[model samples]
Target chain A: MTTAPGSDRSDGLRLSGISKVLGGRTIVEKMELQVSPGELLCLLGPSGCGKTTTLRMIGGFLNPDAGRLTINGVDHTHSKPERRPTAMVFQNYALWPHMSVAKNIGFGLKVRKLSADKIRQKVDWALDLLGLQHHRETMPARISGGEQQRVALARALVLEPEVLLMDEPLSNLDAKLRVQVRETIREIQQRLGITTVFVTHDQEEALSIADRIAVMNNGRIEQLAAPAELYARPRTTFVAGFIGTMNTLDVGPAGGGVPLDDGALLPCDTFSGAAGDVCWIRPEDLQITEADHAGSVRAVVLRVIPRGHYREVLLQSHGSTLRAFTDGEPDVEQIVGLRATNALVYADDALVQDDEPARPGRAVRAVADSGDRG
Target chain B: MTATDTAPAAPAAPDKPVTPSSGARSPRRWSMLFMASPPVLLVLVFVGIPIVIGIAFTLGYTGGLNSIASMLSVSVYTANGWMPSLAAYGNVLSSERFRSDLGVTIWVTVLTVAIVLVLAWCIALYARLSGGRLGKMLSGIAIIPLFIPVVIGAYAIRQFYLNTGFLVSLGRQFGIQLPSWSYHTPGIVIGQVWVSLPFAVLLISSGLAAVPNALIDAARDAGASLGRSVWSVMVPMTTIPTVIVATFTAVGVMGSFTVPYMIGPTSPNMLGVTLQATFVAYLRPQDAQVIAVVLFVLAAGIGALYVWANARASRSSAVQL
Candidate 1:
């Protein structure tokens, strides 16, 4: 599914059964992906989830222990990084400190043995495109970090490679700059129509920029879908939880219905396949109402934290704690009802069936500790 | 475009309203000056006094009153002819023996600095890139010379390169006639390089440490080979450290006596050896003093370059931060 540059109807980049073993541990496992021309696909996951490793493999910085990578329909699994038609904007923005901004951006073109005029034309275009024209003659060290980040993007774009890879490109920037630079990157990607693979731990960044998001954990893709589809109908528990806050409740069959914690039996017909399924309701989807309102579960408010746009209300039901977002302030210790909307159900730990169930218990406990620590 | 419009523009301004806290700050400033006086006084006593005495001696004013007058009145020193103090300097500068000695010193310094810098760069780059047991061992071996006494190291080098030295004997055992390298310019340069290598390696290795691995990776991703990446990226980025290495090595080699004295040829000697000979063997103290001043000036000129390089490095780094 690879096609050369300027070819139409191309599968921009594909990874089939790609796996990587590092330090006797599989950092990436059997990752399969396909991106159409002019699409930005994000590898979204928490730290150590093999997202960066996958991006590196795609960029030819790391070789897959197994499986193959095809770019524009040609096998590049064993190609050296320089030989691949891929460019990466490193997390640290890796701009050459000794070079001027123009030199840094034109380095790749120069390496390709382009004529000075050709290199200058492309570099100047990138400089104007990224709004970095004023800083072209300044040394990289003299510019701001946000400006350096743009220079890094310009450098990669000057090559006009088939696939652009970014490893948390905005991570080094301040919060305000991160959003600003992120939008700049999105605009550039759309304008150039270069197939792109962006790796980031920030779910919002992925949701805002990517045509599709691949939620990964423990070296495997948990779910790969459009951001709305993944958020509204996550295929797995990890995907549901990682993409955003998911209030997961353990469910079991009781008579003809699935029983929840607060004496409510959800209709079993919708989740008939799995016996021990986990229901995932996003915090925003869980509407908090007065106790008198018709609801799925009754809970006592534990705390309320205002999040500017909405107030996050924490609730306790039986032995489980759940969170919900509300527009109004919910009093602490007040009994309230939580109604789930757009809830999803997945067979618990199905992707990791070979893993022991005992580990999840410890993982849950660790999550609790970290939650309390925060 | 809207993103740029709303972005928190550069960093926050560093300005803060200043209050006049003279009562609190004056005592702290005075205390700082007081604590800093000892080293300043020590340098004035040791280095400053000797340089003043040496300048007076070179001006042909050895007596206390005449030296004081020479220091006070520059015209008195220059009254005989233009720059009368430069007579001894001119005599030494024109001497055939001194000219050859100066050339020898310059050649040895240049050769030693070049060799030492190359060796140090290779070793340091190896250590930085490999980062394995071999890398650690190479790094350890590079700094071993630093712990060895220079005299002992110089003597060891002489033994290794002499006609009946270890290398020649080893060659003889293999039925080879190896050329004797004892009492030669190359022999002196070898000794100087060996002694000067540790500091150069340490300086350059620290620079290599400061280089982020990602920058090299970026260069590689830009289609540069490993060697090209190092040459274009690492070499340019570490210019200050390299300058520091070259300057320090040159100064060390220019003023060095023990290594050259131990292994260098007796004829066409370096400045260090010739200065000793001029003062002790020929009993020409004034001429030797002239040579010493010239050598000091040459080393000081290099030292000034090092200071400038260091300042530039710091200024650029500050801008980066």
Candidate 2:
């Protein structure tokens, strides 16, 4: 979706050095985040990673021990939740069980004390926008889960808040329904162009919907980048392992390059700072071939798992297990040779460098021929 | 393990059928039946039998359509029969004494219930807002009255109202004498409220707790003020429990005999005190029974109304959820 020119220039929200200490534990450390106008940022993390705490602080449900929150360049750090120009959709929907769908949608407008006719008009408009016009008179419990989710979304959207905060809004749905409902949410959010911060632990949900994903760990943002950037160029070992599958290899310096225990000399970029080493190669980066292929390390195939488009081979080599994905099936119990076009070296759980030469390596050669398939 | 092995052996012996006699009743079912029997029997005895007896008494010998027929006939009352007893009701209704007493009872009941409900809600809200140590302390303090006997509470209030009582003595030091409990309705109302406030607070507090914290956060995020959140969301969501509490409070106040009997003045009396006076002071069993029946009907009607209103509110509220 394309935005109108100059729309992205607005400073939607900025959280500066936010920190929270609850029950003698640092629930949210000094965190910083900036959301541009018309961008949907997902605060992706596992439970207890402080994503929800950060969202609550921004929404004014909580006061940070030390921080300033600025929205549209206006500091609203100590403002009450009611005074903040943000609406939240809770995980359980949190639709007022005592109000009709129209009333629930128009609750914010009513609290603002709009005239009855105006509230009626706005309520009708919101219900229509959510395709809930027919269920306007129905109670929240009378509606289906998906419809309730829409009511929650409509209730937040009707206020036309500058920022929308959602806390695992689709976690309550079944697998099939979660995908369906998230698509609806994404469409509505994009159409409205409201800057939103969605908190979720599901990696796929975050990657599929967020304009930018903030992978949080231990009350801190480990890495924040565009979805593709996060997946392809993860800055830290945590990000790489957390984002997708990888096969880690232990290596140490041998001859002029790092040598795996299996006696394979893998060239490395000297600037990578890899020492006393461990290196990680993504499974898909590994190419499996029949035995006797030159420049390839031989390993015995342990098992083959069919993964739809590709087969994942678990191989035992030099007392270590290495997983590699290949398009063609390799015979089990047969010695197979594996070669990785690219690998990331890590020392003590920190990514040190890519295992490709800065000047000349297999990755460079492949890029020259096929423009780098991965 | 043994049971599984025996199951296959039973099947192997096709001549022996799987019968209720062959398989002993599951111990689990036996325990469940044992657990269920006491309450069933208790309800049958305490609730069931009394209702049946009351209905029988209402329709049969004690008083039925016959009682109304007897009242209609003048032949039964030639300076005898039920004349003097029926005259007592007429005399009580017409007299200024009756007017004052009835007014006193109505005002006392109203004031007591109002004070109790308001105080209970405030305490409950305070408990809900305060967490950890302070919340626990406040909740513990709120129910302290429950552990104290009703007579003790009445006596405490009585002592507080006496001329030499703490507040009264302090007032006298400032040269302002406080009125005694005998002359004040507030004293009785306070005592009644104190006796009943804990129960109401407990009920309402549990109801408040039942309201999802998410809904409160949602309402606040949607621009609702604290007061608006309470009225629009919290109270409505807890309408059933609140009605239940209020009904209990009303019925309790209507049937209250101890607090008022101990502290109420001699000149103006509540229905409970009046009912006691008819039975004890006047030694009039029939008149007391009639008044007792009236009080029962009033309390029962209020209780029924509360249940009906609560059920209706719950039904409407359930649809919203």
Top-scoring candidate (TM-score): 1
Which segments of model 2 are wrong by more than 4 Å? A1-9, A250-276, A330-334, A347-350, A353-374, B1-99, B313-321
lDDT of 1 by residue, B123-242 (tens): 999999888889878878888989999999989999899999999999999999997777999999889988988888899999999999999999989988888889989999889999
Give the 10-residue window scoring lowest on summed lDDT in candidate 2 chain A.
A365-374
lDDT of every predicted structure (CA atoms): 0.81, 0.77
- Lowest summed lDDT over 10 consecutive residues: which window, candidate 2 chain B? B75-84
lDDT of 2 by residue, A1-374 (tens): 12233334377988879999998999888899999988999998889989999999988999999977888777778889999989999999998877889989989999999999999999888888889999998988898998999999999999999999999999998899899889988999999899999999999999999999999998899999999988876677888888889776666433333355645453333424434366677787777776645545557899999999989999875566778888988888889765566566566666665455433445533332221111
| Isolated chain A TM-score, each model | 0.85, 0.86
Residues B17-68 of candidate 2 have per-residue lDDT tens digits of 6666445556667889999999999999998775554433322223453355
Pull out the clashing pairs in model 2.
A141-B321
User: Worst 10-residue stretch by lDDT in candidate 1 chain A?
Assistant: A351-360
Instruction: Write one digit per residue (lDDT tens) for candidate 1, span A1-374.
Output: 24444444376788989999999999999989998889999999999999999999988888899998888877789888888989999999999988899999988888889999999999999999999999989998787889989999999998888999999999988999999999999998998899999999999999999999999999998888999987766667777677778777776433333345654442222332334466555787777766634324456899999899889989985556878899988899998755544445456554222222211223333333232223
What is model 1's interface RMSD?
Answer: 0.9
Highest DockQ scorer: 2
Question: TM-score of the second chain in each model?
Answer: 0.85, 0.72
Model 1: clashing residue pairs?
A2-A72, A2-A73, A3-A72, A3-A73
User: Model 2 RMSD to the real structure?
Assistant: 7.3
Number of clashes recorded per candidate: 4, 1
